[model samples]
Target chain A: MKIIYTSFIGFVFLIVCSSIIISDLKGPESLILGSWDEVSWEYERVNSTENSNLPLDNLVKKEICSNMFIHEAETWVFKKNNRLQLVKRGHEEEELIYNLRGRGNILEMIHKDNGTEIYQIQDLTKNKLVLHFNFDLQVKGIVKMTFSKVD
Target chain B: MLRKFNNYRTHQDNLKIAILTACSAGMVNVLSVILFFAFTSNVTGHYAILAQEVAKGNWYQAAIVFIWISLFLIGNFTSNMLIIHSKPGKSTYLAHATPLILEIICLLTVSIYLQRFYLNTLWETEFLVALMLFAMGLQNGLTASITNFSIKTTHLTGLTTDLGLLFSMFTKKKYRKDKKLRRKAQILLSVVTAYMFGGISAGILHIKVGYAAFYIVCVLLGIILFYDYSVLKIKRRKRSLFTRKNILFSKKTL
Candidate 1:
């Protein structure tokens, strides 16, 4: 009887505490809204065999960066209705569906007819968003992308 | 390998299952992470995601995660049910083998489906992840139930906690001298090593052969199934030979 009573109390306590904390928290769906400018892209962890100090800006002109969908985009717009627009300076705009998984740490971008891509959300704040994803190419490494929210 | 249950099992038996199943669990977990961008062996992260989805009002995603969690649960339930309800004597081994057979079927289906019909869609990935989770649940359930909860291969959270506790207890000489405690530490260490080996091997295999690596896990589980039957066969043969020799000696003496 004592054990059952304590268990019940513990369960109720957990429920109340969780509800309180959840009410104050904001979901990533709301946090990721509006336009964000691409701040930079760099190798988070380059393959040991690859040149560690290679400049990504020069590499951006190479096939490695060209193959990535986001490489050409200057601005990312996350709109309502689960749509994400990749806007480039001169190229045509591309739209994709967006979803969050893994406690909102996994950013899933589903491209139309191109399948889905996932990025680990390294950091997310009101002003900035940092994403980490595997960059598979001639010289493969983990890529870290930073985006500053546009006012 | 699968016949013994609970108190009837020895440390060697538990160790064998732990190493084999932990390796497969590690492989399945890593494969799911690399291929589907999700986890299969452990549902801890998935539970958090489900909660987040619900809070965000993403009903569709929440439903999908719910299904994945439910399938894992069902897999465990099915395994335990088969074990506890198994008939006495002759059919015990078959009942234990049934869960692994079902697990093999699940993994084989995933492998074949991915190789042939996979369209690289989000829905397909989610479904594959769910199937993998179910298979892992079956494995974990069978190993745990049969070994009296001494072996759980799918995740390390609880194992780590127990190891920590045991380590603290081992600070005292009494616990160190205890045979059961020492054997447990050894089993835990071996399990950790085997799980790491499995994960590393799966990562390398995924790089080399892609999704075809799942077949290796099935092959390993098949060995576990075949081991006990072979041992039984050899033991029976030895018994028969011994009896024949005894009868020949008696006839000569007469």
Candidate 2:
């Protein structure tokens, strides 16, 4: 009985491990390679502004930013070879090269003028992608961009 | 080891399970984060993310987080269902072992997929995350059920809450002196320490060996499963041998 039990366990472990080993190898595919369209944008203040003392002032600023910049329709093309293109309505297309760092969650976009912007990938999927980055606009805040797969 | 299952389990047995399972949970959870950038063993963070996504009106992201939480729920349901519906006869060991075996299979499958066909796609990451959540659900459910909800290893929220409550209660001299409370405190501390150690070790090991960290978890679970079986088999052999000797002695006397 002892031998049988031990052998059974050994057999199962061997089978499971070997099955993994014998499985076909798949080539590494980048998760970010695709055409994406901007679906939504969210902005939140992380730190209070030193100058804006009134609560209503911050709210007005947020409202203005939301109305002015939140719903612009834009498309982004991310190629497999680390090329990125931003397309906006009635605007010149901006071309950039991107490098994915740290488990491919941190995206660093290199601009033509020797500038770089880093965005944290909050979420990524076949049909959806969410990117977040922090910046200062009289107050330190985060901007989140949500994208839907266009192609 | 097998006797603990048939009889009332002692504090030591509970502590052993608590420490070992907590270590396994920590290692698996941290390793998943390192590899997939996703949390698999616990649903608390997923719930928070779901709420945040919903608040932001990101319906697609919300749905994905919702699905991850559901997978965890399903895993727990599956584990408890197996435990509750298992026939109450000689096959009890099989019932108890079933969940662990299932967990092993899940971990093994994830490890195999990562080793063989990891494409770093969204679908692949979601699938692996779901698989891990289910595995953890099985482990959490089994440990909780066997120990009467006193040993939860997968998530630290409840454990930390309990620790806080225990610390508050220990302020009273009577509660501090209570042997049961003391034992519970010791068990909780040991589990927490083991979990932290496991997480730290997994962090270092994952950096050194990558996905092989998962294989180590598999081996740890395999030991638990086979150790129980081996002990049972030894006890059964001893009983049979003793029974045969008694029969021979009776025949000679007659």
Candidate 3:
């Protein structure tokens, strides 16, 4: 009886494992691969913008060149040979290279210049992409992000 | 020397039992994540992308999958309680039987609804989630119950951490390793590995076959039921045969 039970379990295990293998091999579109571009971004405050009491319309037109890099650029790139190289001319010198693997349309990338930091592509679409990056503010580390896409 | 050797053998047997428990528990957690990933990423995640529908405030549709999550929680709660309370040997059949019946009814209901009335869009998603929750609950509950508290198949957050502890203890080599602890580690690992593999497989299936994953669950439950019944029938036959032989022997003696 014990032997029977053991064999029965083994049989079930084999069946389940085989099913997974077959499904994994069954398709191509299941692989998320392609070029994606940034459309818009949502940013976290670097410091109290208390210095500026600008109105909403003026704020939209305001592009302050403060030393603090509060905004991040959203960029998309195509991938081949397991590596994704972004085509943005200025950002090319930047460590922001994307790699495609695992599941879905997810991409993993690293900022080369700032080797200390990492970013996760939280969400993406044909027109829009969302990126999350972490930084230290005060004593604690915090996450902030930008959403962007090509018009 | 011989007496001492026998003691060593029992200790070894106990070790195997512990290992199996730890493995099974780990498998449960991995599989749960895998199932969730597969369902959301491949099978049904697309529904959420219907922004137009969402903008219309289709609460019914939005709430459908969540309700399934709720049902699954209910199933787990029930099964966990039942397993914890019931005598180990007596509860195995019940563990497998209850979910099997519930799943079948759910499936039939879905098919009928599709064939007969136009189900509200919200109702359709809710129904699917409910079916999934109930089925998963049964699967996890029965597996957990049969194995006792030693193996949990539905979730793994606890198992992986426990395995880490056991690994450290093994490394320290300070105190005499407890045989009971060793048995637990084995069970936890087996369950954990199996469930993780199951989830990966289910994820792949979700991509290729859609909700047919539920059908597979149904089949596995059926297999479990058949196995339990067959074992019971054999036990009954053996008992009846023993009784007949005893009666004949008494007649001859008389």
Q: Please report the candidate that would top lDDT against the real structure.
A: 1
Q: Rank the candidates by lDDT, best first.
A: 1, 2, 3
Highest-scoring model, TM-score: 2
**TM-score, prediction 3:** 0.46
* Candidate 2: stretches off by over 4 Å: A1-48, A51-77, A80-118, A122-151, B1-7
Instruction: Write down the lDDT of every candidate, Cα atoms only.
Output: 0.81, 0.74, 0.45
For all candidates, the clash counts are 0, 0, 43
DockQ of each: 0.07, 0.05, 0.03
The TM-scores of all predictions, comma-separated, are: 0.70, 0.71, 0.46
lDDT of 1 by residue, B21-97 (tens): 99999998888877766889999888987898778665545666777777788799899999999877756789999
lDDT of 1: 0.81
> What is candidate 2's lDDT per residue for A3-68, written digit by digit as tens?
999976875664454345323322113557778888766554435565332223446546755753
DockQ of 3: 0.03
Top DockQ prediction, candidate number: 1
* lDDT for A57 (candidate 1): 77
lDDT digits (tens) for residues B12-54 of candidate 2: 8788778888888999988887666667888987888778877
- Reported per model, the fraction of native interface contacts reproduced equals 0.00, 0.00, 0.00
